[model samples]
Target chain A: MKLEDQRTTVYKVDPDHPETESLPTLRTEELLLNMGPQHPSTHGVLKVILELEGERLVKSTPVMGFLHRGVEKLAEGGTYHQFIPHTDRLDYVCAMYNNFAYCRAIEKLMDITVPDRAEYLRTIVAEVQRIIGHLFWLGTQALDIGAMTVFFYTFRDREILLDWFDELCGARLTTSWYRIGGVEKDFTPSLFEKLKKFLEYFPPKIDEYVIFLEKNRIWLARTRGVAVISAEDALSFGLSGPTLRGSGVDYDLRKYEPYSAYPRCEFSVPVGKNGDTYDRYWIRVEEIRESLKIVTQCLEQIEPGPILADVPSVTLPPKDRVFTNLESMIQQFKLFSQGFEAPAGEIYCGTEAHKGELGFYIVSTGGGNPYRLKIRAPSFIHMGAFDFMSRGYMIADAITLFGSYDIVMGECDR
Target chain B: MHAIAEKIQEKFPAGFLNAQEWRGDLAITVKREALHDVCTYLRRDPDMDCDYFVHVSSVDWPDDEERFEVVYEVYSIRKRHRIRIKTRVPEHDCIVDSMTDLWYGADFMEREVFDMMGIRFRNHPDLRRILMPDDYTEGYPLRKDFPVQGKGWRDSFDFLQDPN
Candidate 1:
């Protein structure tokens, strides 16, 4: 007989976020279940340890670090520049932001900077990556909420953006495109022109999403007030990005602590009144529009100039110079051999990444390699709001709430 | 100076909040002793409520007199202001007073501090290993001295990855 009619049957426990509550009601007659560290919905080695009271979740504890390679501690052992590639692992959905945050931190420590042209390009690509990331969230969140067709529509644009990323960097997901001083190379004008075309057509695609899901009676019914977090609770748990903004907390690192020429660009940070699954969903939709604004602004401001800085002490010598001049070759050899040494100081630089506030804190001991590197991943803290918010709601609410938080396991595990 | 943060720099000292106008960007330093007071004042004072705890994480300062430094980044939802507060702690003993009392939302965060940094929370209710096995033995990995794979590089606990 199916377990739905049989109260005697039991199920396996979800290993990633299993229920964390002790239900005395279930003490006598309940069956517990395991979900997955390897399932379609579990998405990568994420396991949820769940306790159930007859198909209803009694408690949930997220099991993390299943894929932990100790990226933080490993960063301490590697040279400062060597660690940029390491950050690529975190938030695999938007590795550009990950590399950008790490490199931005090093750039701040060195007190060196990118040329205006590079900064403008960085802004443009960052927003493009942002659009791609939100598309992933929209697709996956919709899939989890039972809107399967929307996933296909959402990924259609996402696939196009991913190809753009591939065109710039050899890798699609883990592109260490952003270097400490500036970008790796001057993007071909063709890339920018293509991106301009994307920016022009993307807003109407977002409108399609809004019409498909935003005002849909069924979508709103599942998301509205499903799991509400007060602005206070959201902040206390170290919320950032859309989750914090969704709770009516108008804090965005781009606006508050602008890096990479964010200040020069004019864009709005969309906010939501109630911190719920629905609001989080809407905020991302709104943020995509704002990212489109940024892409447009970047297209207009971009100029023809050197992408990398003249500081050969930190930046690599141009290939042309390396092949022609001994001085340039020696500078290249020195930069590659010893790496760049920053002044003795510690600093934290945060970027309003797609997941949330992806921050990199660097401790420079006046050496070529960093003394220590710590990443302030937003998913770990955003997950903190999960248990508090999921209480009293049905088991299905956890799915919507998880999607609303817009978690990426790589960031959480790291 | 930016429109919003420029006004703040005018009222406070150049060194206050560990921020000074350097090429039109902001950076500030606050000692551990005054860390609590600075945050309380920021939360209470109308001028600077940077009140939302956007993040709380520590940086390993190996050569300095203080080896570990924890930063408190607060944002005022009402004012849209952001302020970063840093508190340094010596390596020999890492302890930072709990802020959960002021913000109940910090209960888990304090516990997370205890878990990741092994910084003793003076009044936290439950302080145990989080994001790691309960029986695992090692110093704080986030600390500069602690090895990335741990000191022994041996698994002391089998609670996780156990087949039985």
Candidate 2:
């Protein structure tokens, strides 16, 4: 039996049941409760102002911006390269993907082309990050909704991915591994070996998760058709990533825009028939399987080449250049001091990460810094769809619906 | 080749649709003020169903007289082409027509523009603070004109002087 449908003695009231009288408007009973800004299952510091009708949420207005560090504004204060490190913190869970998105936008404005090898490397890291991100979502969502054991099993494998990330960059989560020109380095040999091993072993482990939840009758009854959002409604709300695909839109940035060498990589966008909590859950789980495919392809196809592009002014010269030649020393000084200059035009670049379409709209005035950079985070838009879906469902399903959306609050507030 | 820009070019012959480019899937552009008519045509015109409003975001351009440029990323899943419409509003008159009637998705996005940029949306329903606190009325945060680090942080626990 589902934990939600089972009567828990928290409030001694089942407000969702229509057979019970509509909640009374007694001044003593009605308490205006704050759900988050710190509470678990809110995903991040998402504060929801939920007015209670005696245990049932009558009106819920999501209050954001507690975590807003004026990122977009702070970006304007610094040079173009200075903003790259800031992007790492926007969506801390998927830092590489954020780095990729911000750099791609600047590249678009500057009219620079990334090397094929760098694109492939980005794809490998992006897909792996997607797997890691979705696993975090599935684990946390399940645990938040009462399936506690999923977290234990899910984090065990999550550590393996984080270990690979730590090896790639010094830090596990905030991997500032991308500059404007390309990635920090090519996929190292030791890292590649472990990833190849992971690609081989992770799929069956995903199936283990499926066997635990997908077939369980209680999990199905709890999720299936709980909060149904049609393709039309989802599109209207600007939903993307797994949330849009879960509703069977089949519009993924990887498939459509084909950025970061996604066209060369072989991975199908798994879509759903019905747009519900169950479909959203299944789509993410299936995406983990598909991301593994992309990762394997990227590993096999990676070429041994310089990770940074031929552009020395925009890209960092090797540390060897710092010690070796006079001209190389001058170039390194210019790059660090003046930073890279971009053309005077605006360009927007988006990619399919763990989230739907993460886009960066960058406007340049031919200077070393961006004139303006607007981040179109998918979670920020996806969070708007909450009221539409949560209207008829029980209050408990709010946690499930919010989790199924897979929002990272840092990005949303940023 | 998207029809809305083409139609826009034909309709306002002189200087309505300035420049249009198809970046992958979206028909992106730079337009000054005819946003109201362009969006109306996108929805009413049978050829373009851009009926589904995907997202709307604002970017601050501090140097230019036109300080804030709001970008509207729209989509028509029925026809399958996305269009990004843009407009630049001076800091004095940040007010713009709300597209909530055309697509309900614009509701929150408009509120966001109101919240962050302090750009007033004329006809939005619940246009109170969405991101910032209801008590906050000092200045717009997203605008490049806004200061990053103010002399507001307290060294000690100044209980009476919390700015946030």
Instruction: For each candidate, report its DockQ versus the true two-chain complex.
Output: 0.27, 0.42
Which ranges in model 2 have alpha carbons more than 4 Å from their true place?
A1-31, A52-57, B1-3, B12-17, B20-33, B51-54, B61-66, B78-80, B151-164
* Top candidate by DockQ: 2
Fnat, model 1, is 0.42
**lDDT tens digits, residue span A1-414, model 2:** 122322222344566789558776444443455678788999789877555555565556677877877787787778887788888888888888888888887777656788888888888888888888988988998887787778888999999999999999888998988878788766668988898888777878988888888767777877888778998788778888788888888888777656777888787889998999899998899888888888788777878776777777677776687789888888788876677777766666777778878888776777777777778888888888887787556677778888888888889888
Cα lDDT for residue B57, candidate 2: 80
Error of 1 at A56 (Å): 5.8
Worst 10 residues of 2 chain A by lDDT: A1-10
Model 1: how far residue A9 lies from native, Å: 26
Question: In candidate 1, how many Å is residue A350 off?
Answer: 1.4
For each candidate, what is the lDDT?
0.74, 0.77
Report residue A103 deviation for candidate 1 (angstroms).
Answer: 1.9
Give candidate 1 regions above 4 Å deviation. A1-35, A50-59, A214-217, B1-48, B59-68, B77-93, B104-109, B149-164
Fraction of the reference Cα-Cα interface contacts (below 8 Å) that each candidate reproduces: 0.42, 0.53
- For model 2, report DockQ: 0.42
